[model samples]
Target: MTLSVRSRPSALAMVSALVLSLAACGGTTKESVRTQAPAPAASGAASASANPDAPIKEGLKLAFLPKQINNPYETIVDEAGIEAAKEFKAEAKEVGPSDASASSQVSYINTLAQQGQDAILIAANDPNAVCGPLRQARSKGIKVVAYDSDTSKDCRDIFINQASSEDVGRSQVRLLSELIGGEGEIAILSATANATNQNTWIEFMQDELKKPEHAKMKLVKIAYGDDDDQKSFQQTQGLLQAYPNLKGIISPTTVGVSAAARYISGSKYKGKVTLTGLGTPNQMRKFVKDGTVSKFALWNPKDLGYLASYAAAALVSGQISGGEGEKFTAGKLGERTIGAGGEIILGPPFTFDKSNIDEYDF
Candidate 1:
């Protein structure tokens, strides 16, 4: 329950409004820089053809298409985008399907494009399912930014990665290894089967298991809950039954992790089967307190959302060209440098347990 490592402040208070105000008002004294004026649109709405070299304008409208609407996790994340948009003097809206299906986000993407949205930040349900519609949106000049989950790189201008894929994947397996005494049968309760980030992390986890240090750790099965709470709970139960010797579980999705915890807490498997993976403090606090879950890791979803919004604004304003080494100001997050693949890392994932869970609320 105790982490020797220090914890950073949460994104809820990462940046003061004064700093954001200054950044929005064209402050360039330090890490922040002044943004250019937007180019004239060929039509009434902002046009993708408005001139590739033109600056992005202030007060542009932004629409967020998350993996699903009404999800507690996505709601909190998108709220951060809405808040960041206000800080940057832009209008922001969020829309998506209640169900998280591969093609669920396509219609919303088309709607935002037709509505003349200046930018569209999305948490892609599937990497390729929405790429065509997203490409169409980009063709019209809407800056496409992916957060939490990502579409294909060519489909989005920039991806705000919550953490490196390697870190997220390795950390979960490491945590579970320690929790289960380094050797036992473990299974994965994942999100959607085709989720880009989820699939990548699971791959890394499988690779991590192959290391000599984890030779005794056996992977029994990998189950998909599709990020639905009840479905994830059912998957957990099935995993426990399907693999009677299963010693632990790594749920890389917040929804899957929490659902697994909820099931383990009340079942006979309570302390026998350890659970660890990506989850929010608010969702996992009770599990940690009740001794159902020892620890889990996650980057600040709010910060991820904030950075994604800032990235979208920067792209819309033509501040950065989504190229490697492109630099931009991320308001309270201060200056950020783009890395290879047009991705921006929010930060390393934080470990949450009884000792530190209370420090975070989002």
Candidate 2:
């Protein structure tokens, strides 16, 4: 039941004119090829200026605010930004609250503004809850780059997308459908309900499930784990009890998927219920080895951070204005053009299964 769908290579071709010169940076890997459905040509404010002649600013003071501090996934992703900063000779620091609540990130945004940080990168806890603070920082000339998740368009200079929302949503359902024979009672375990990225992906997943081929499958419930391990574990336990015949679960958040795996591996549900979603190899290795999960998907977290740092540097240096046709050089990752909607995609999400799990470390 692995659905064969078309990819959006045409969108990549549309931005070819915006790619600046590519250069080698120390140990940079060849830019991972990105394939995403092109958004409609920019409209409204997003289409205002096609600044193709912006300059690259260097030696900036940068800060990253993830959804939660000390999250394993965020830790690895933010470290990549730190490494990129070092490579580009910029001063970089990571800061955020331990909670993933809607307004938990506002205070960090205010602090970075007061500290006169040249650039700020954040994974918004809620799309609009922190927009006011972010807009206030923008008013102070501090460039903003939203990574992993995004805020309101006016609040940030650019969004560093790990993968297209459509692809991520469709892929998760496609994989889960295959594992469960395209027919069963399935549930979704997601991050915060207010998270823009999580909500978008879930919307597409629900849409994908409505296709005629998947008519036999019924989505039973959608649970929010708030991206916390303890809460996610408890939610999994609750789902199992509430829906005794649940055949599969899709935990699209890294924390949610890993926590669900941990709970299932030790319970009687192991091997009886299928689990699939986004997860790092290190976090999901044991579950995969013990047959708790078949396959899952994720783009490279390091590349996501690396690109976000570059986007921030470019914005601070006035190399780009977050315009549709803007272009900037992303270190060893090479040249990246700003696409419609102020998005700079990293690449497609890769699947990690038993056969290829050992090949990835982050």
Candidate 3:
């Protein structure tokens, strides 16, 4: 069921029948009779009633708010979401702060709410800092969808997770262990300290390192780059200087990984220290070709945004109400089911290296 870039369009034909079949099911159809009472609204669940048969509303206004406007990875994700809006005849636009600070996005959230957007897709920089504004938006009947990064469970209707948090965290540790021969001092160059996604993944990496197989590996320090290029470059230098015996480094953010690679490429640590984490193919290609990096991993950013857009539309159209076991068609990505905690995982991440890096464009 893994999707490659070339195979996504072909899946539409295969899933079209499934969509029709689900719509025709007697008991599940919107027009069917029901004996059970409608479920009470959970803390973060959508308040709107479900209408599974309702067609996607046209000319709906959707707004995407990322952590910052300049991050290339977020740019790709937001662009894909905007494209998806076009497919369903919705008007979508991207807006956000220039800096990824804890409260930088507050003003934008307030503005989007005031503008009466039907839905707002956000990647929260700080989970709690934006909770108040998110609540205000939800009070206005705006559908809130968190993607890439997340807010607390009670703050959003749905979270479009790129992959399982546990899988992403543990995989980074395993990849680094294999590269550094299973033993030595290592460090994590992360994004902001309060970033929900980064902190969650780092916690899993720490838990994975406690296993007996990784006993020889020591995670000495975790330095925050705040997702800034110059800061990440400096932090990489600091990590190497602070732990001269460091064998590897893992940076789970795209900005941090690329910055770390640039620093390692021209420094003495290029061949001695191994670097691995989540990164886009195009951004890491030059480093991989020059032998500065051996391997890294990430899911398709375009698909992440595309799926998020559809999920938001489903919420607005009342196709589902952010409840567990609810299902909706994500256009070409096919039918997606909501899991516990209002989460929809895109899929497992794909690893990249010199062997197959050339095969991907983003």
lDDT for 261 in candidate 1 is 94
Q: Residue 323 deviation, candidate 3, in Å?
A: 0.6
Determine the backbone clash count of candidate 3: 0
Cα lDDT tens digits for candidate 2, 98-199: 999999988888777777788789999998999888777777667789999988787787898888888889989999999999999999999999999999
Ranking by TM-score: 3, 2, 1
The stretch of ten residues in a row with the least summed lDDT in candidate 2 is 19-28
TM-score to native of every candidate shown: 0.86, 0.86, 0.89
Best candidate according to TM-score: 3
Q: What is the C-alpha local distance difference test score of candidate 1?
A: 0.78
Q: Which digits, one per residue and each the tens of the lDDT, describe model 3 over residues 1-362?
A: 12233345444343323211110000111222222322232343443467767889998788999999888889889899989998999988889988899999999988887777788899999999998888888877778899999998777888999888998999999999999999999999999999999999999999999999999999999999999989999999999998999999999999999999999999999899999988988899999999999999888788888999999999888898888777889898888988888888887777788867665576
Which prediction has the highest lDDT against the true structure? 3
Q: The CA-based lDDT of model 3 is what?
A: 0.84
lDDT of 3 at 105: 92
